[model samples]
Target: MGVKAWLSKPLAAYVHKKHQSWIQNPVEAQQSVFESIIKTAQHTAFGRDHHFSEIKTHADFVEAVPVRDYEGLVAYFNRVKEGEQNILWPGKPLYLAKTSGTTSGTKYIPITKDSIPNHINGAKDALLSYIHETGNSSFLDGKMIFLSGSPVLEQVGGIHTGRLSGIANHHVPGYLRTNQLPSYETNCIEDWETKLDQIIEETIDENMTLISGIPPWVQMYFDKLMQQTGKQIKDIFPNFSLFVYGGVNFEPYRKKLFESIGREVDSVETFPASEGFFAYQNEQHDRGLLLLLNSGIFFEFIPTDEYFNEKPTRLTIGEVEVGVNYALVVSSNAGLWGYSIGDTVKFTSVKPYKLIVSGRIKHYISAFGEHVIGEEVEKAMQRTMQKYPMVELVEFTVAPYVSQDKGQSFHEWLVEFSIAPANEEAFAKELNAQLQKLNTYYDDLITGRILADLKIRALPQGTFRHYMKSQGKLGGQNKVPRLSNDRKLAEGLIESADALNTNKN
Candidate 1:
């Protein structure tokens, strides 16, 4: 190890020792964070309107604030966007994280000075945790790259605003700044393809060690590099050791990513969003990401089955149980209260509050009441991949095929394959069998013949990327929905893939 890597081991040990204080006493840490944020925001407009002063316990806070998604709280966010101070949190926000929205067009989530550290430190400690465990921090001496959004911020109502990743770029520690790659000018290129080309040009010859990004984009980077240089990633960057990823599950992309790299590299998964930095993989195991209890965000969970009820039972860390899917809710210093971040998680370990993201509340295939979720499909796919070792997938999505005629309905899977399985029909059957094993409701439908066995439609290569580019969301945290109830996205994928194939021909 280099001097820097050698020194990081001691620092990593110190950080891990400090983190144990909360990891051991999670409930107390959560309670402290709850009191701190509530007390701080009590004077703000939302707090006063919700009777924050009268609140003393979790029940009191729950009664004072009703759980709401972005649509329900847009009024307060609108006021803030129009230059209102203390509308949600004290004074003005430090920055607004701009994100694409389906109905709202664009959302501006507040990131206060106090809350930003949680975002920065959660990522930092993940790396430190890895170093503390493996004592391998030599990667620190080599170049690192975080494929991210443009760092250019646009002023919104007198506040600096940009994508969450872009906002995070400005806060990278000075120590790591020298090791980071893809020049500022290159990152600012709004288009993903251009930015990626520039990235390859800049980092191809560097001793790259760590690469961080959402899996799809990183896959694209690898694909481009291999195409350009005719060499696997390991050959190009022999020192590369760590891969940091978030936004989506990694299992689906694991095979292809490893095949591209030509070897297995240690990786850390993080659970972050515009709302807050929630969790990170503290250990190099499948134990699940460790939830942040001492961060500036207080968490709440509603059982997924009860999320749509008139008033769902909100469970605090003390009440949450392992193996139950819960809709994640939060009250954060960033001025979001009883906010549903649209994510569903299941605690894998209640002691340390380690959880795996299950799926999104709005993104599922329940058209026939089977309620197939992202986690189920991902697990099913992982099983199928294990069964068919030769198969390699680029991307896939599922949607219900509701029949208007007298024909039986079924689920449709659109998949893009880099290495197609030997027998497509057999591959589809294995996938369907795996899905039935994971979801009993789906199994019942299949057995009863209420729904036909799921159908697989092989999509042309580059179809998903082409579709994303056509929609103006080619990179920087944009992800294809894993499952949808309706056929809107399914139909679009078919059309886009057909068009792409035609144009190529």
Candidate 2:
């Protein structure tokens, strides 16, 4: 056996043992994690203020800390950004991950030493879990490429701030450094298009065994690779065996990705987010990611339907039931206390505690993995509407046009305009461009034809009112859903609007 192949046996063994122990007594494991974090930060301002000394049990902890989103945490984060140590965690965070949050403003999530290991070790153990399950260790023998965000970190306060990818780029272990693809310089390129070109040039001839990224961006790479070489991905990298993906559902992208590669290969789905490395695929199964029970993060689940209530019930790991959508809450060493990350998930298994990502608690359109949240679309529309001074939007909803029978698939925007734009075609063109500028993932998808241009359908002013009335939800805090993953809401609006035209005749 080779050095890498030999090394993996021990690695896989370690992951299996740790995972086994984690699932065995999850309740005590979680309680221990919660206590460790609270005790470690007990001397901090937040700890003292919350009277961490009196907190001894889960009930006490729950009562002391309430679930909060970015809005509530931002005050503490502002102190952290200003170089205040022990405000949240024991020491200052070395880096911050900048990402879009529940608000229109950007969020800067602190990344501390204690929290960083969860990202690295969790990823390692997840890959090791796959190896343990399938006996595939040959992947370690060749280069593995991770298509990630730029590593060019910007200095904020006394620390650096960038994407979670940028922070991780600095800590690639020596053992894996030699086996990682896309040279450091190329990985640091700010512009994704330029960086992608360099990655293709640098690793085209290498013995690549694994590829990792969000699917849409990876599909763009695969398409570009095929176009450049006039050969399939399997032909280019005969040893390519694994595809690791997260950030969006893989079902819609699976067929396209397999076609791009020209063959079937092992794929592993994970549930890593900027907030923390939450879960990963341990078995060859769809729609269930094993929860990271032993990670230094205490978890809570709130049913989606009751989340908006003033005092919603928060269920612990022991209390969660399978098949119910719950908004996840986490209290971790990262100094986030009972923070809600906005993503909702449904538990699929109880014994090992597995879950499937359902959708967002916030309304957003991620139909093709673009993750185009409401703030982004709304901001783009507000900017585009500046030129059309006389136009007034009554209501609107966006949906994916994903019919294979239809030649060109696009995002169909059904809008109710009280006052119409001077030129509807010009309005649509400008709106599309604004969206491209707001979201890099959407732009990349558009460039690759993974998605087509945005199309607008104008409706009369009362279309929204009529549609809502049909649903018996008229006029009392009742609003149309702004976005949808499927065509149900969009089709309803279109049909309702068409009936208005028929009546006008």
Please name the candidate that would achieve the greatest TM-score relative to the true structure: 2
Tens digits of lDDT, candidate 2, 279-301: 99889865589999778899999
* Cα lDDT computed for each candidate against the true fold: 0.87, 0.85
How many clashes (backbone atoms < 3 Å, residues ≥3 apart in a chain or on different chains) does model 1 have?
0
Root-mean-square deviation per candidate: 14.3, 2.7
Off by over 4 Å in 2: 102-104, 368-370, 401-411, 429-453, 460-466, 469-476, 497-505
lDDT of 1: 0.87
What tens-digit string does per-residue lDDT give for candidate 1 at 1-505? 7777888999999999998999899889999999998899999999999988888999999788999988789999999898899989999998999864434546789998889998899889889999998888989999999988789999988899998889999999988888988888998887676677899999999999999987756877888899899999999999999999997656646887899999999999998888989999888876599998998999999999999998899999999999999999999999999999888999999777899988778777755546577877888899999999989999999998865444566899999999998899999999999888777557745764557899999999999998898899999999999988678888889999989988988
Best by lDDT: 1
TM-score of every candidate: 0.75, 0.92
